[model samples]
Target: MKQLIVEIDETTEARIIIAAKTAGLSAQQWLKRIIDEKTVSSWPDSVKALAGSWQDVPFAEELRSGEGREKTY
Candidate 1:
């Protein structure tokens, strides 16, 4: 596994230590869990179900197709 280093203020470090203790994990483990959560590659179900749902809306193609640029004088 690769290693990473981060520099944080004393107050923030203290907060992480306290949070780790509350969750019964070491500070390194708690930080790793947070990084894993933020790096997940999956989207939520609500957003996944919205695919192609707006294709039929009025002028949706013209508004989003990037083909109509304003002419400058």
Candidate 2:
């Protein structure tokens, strides 16, 4: 819900536009998703114990507990 002014390479911007359209999403939305993925959360491993039923185990958790979070189904 905020406006952002970012500079991208001309060719890269065009490629993002085409890829976003092919994926049935707007360019902004596609970029937001990518940004969200690369930005790691600061949540500690102990936080997982507080996250009830939360899946997708954090990388930190995998190392501490030696229990990877892979969907059984």
Candidate 3:
């Protein structure tokens, strides 16, 4: 594991400590979780689980079929 050194103002450091405490995590754990969330490349599980959930919504192809679009000259 690599060690990271950051220089933050006292107020910011206090805020991070407070936030970590509120989340029931150490500052390091909270920061690691935040970094992981920020660096993620794929959709989170909660969002992926929403796929095919909106049965009434039109698909991309249906919306692009130009059914109600105005004709151009």
Report the C-alpha lDDT of model 3 over 15-65, residue by residue, as the tens digit.
999999999999999999999989999998999999999999999998889
Ranking by TM-score: 3, 1, 2
What is candidate 2's TM-score against the reference?
Answer: 0.51
**Per-residue lDDT of model 1, residues 1-73, tens digit only:** 8878899999999999999999999999999999898998999889999987997676867677766677578
Residue-pair clashes, model 1: 0
TM-score of 3: 0.72
lDDT of each structure?
Answer: 0.90, 0.82, 0.96
Candidate number with greatest TM-score = 3
2 or 3, greater by TM-score: 3
Candidate 3: residue 43 Cα off by (Å): 1.2
Model 1 per-residue lDDT at 34: 96
Q: Each prediction's Cα RMSD?
A: 5.8, 11.8, 3.7
When summed lDDT is taken over every stretch of 10 residues in candidate 1, the lowest stretch is 60-69
| lDDT tens digits, residue span 1-73, model 2 | 7898988899999999999999899998899888986896877677766865656656665666745556575
lDDT of 2 at 57: 55
Which candidate leads the pack in lDDT?
3
| Model 2 spans > 4 angstroms off | 42-73
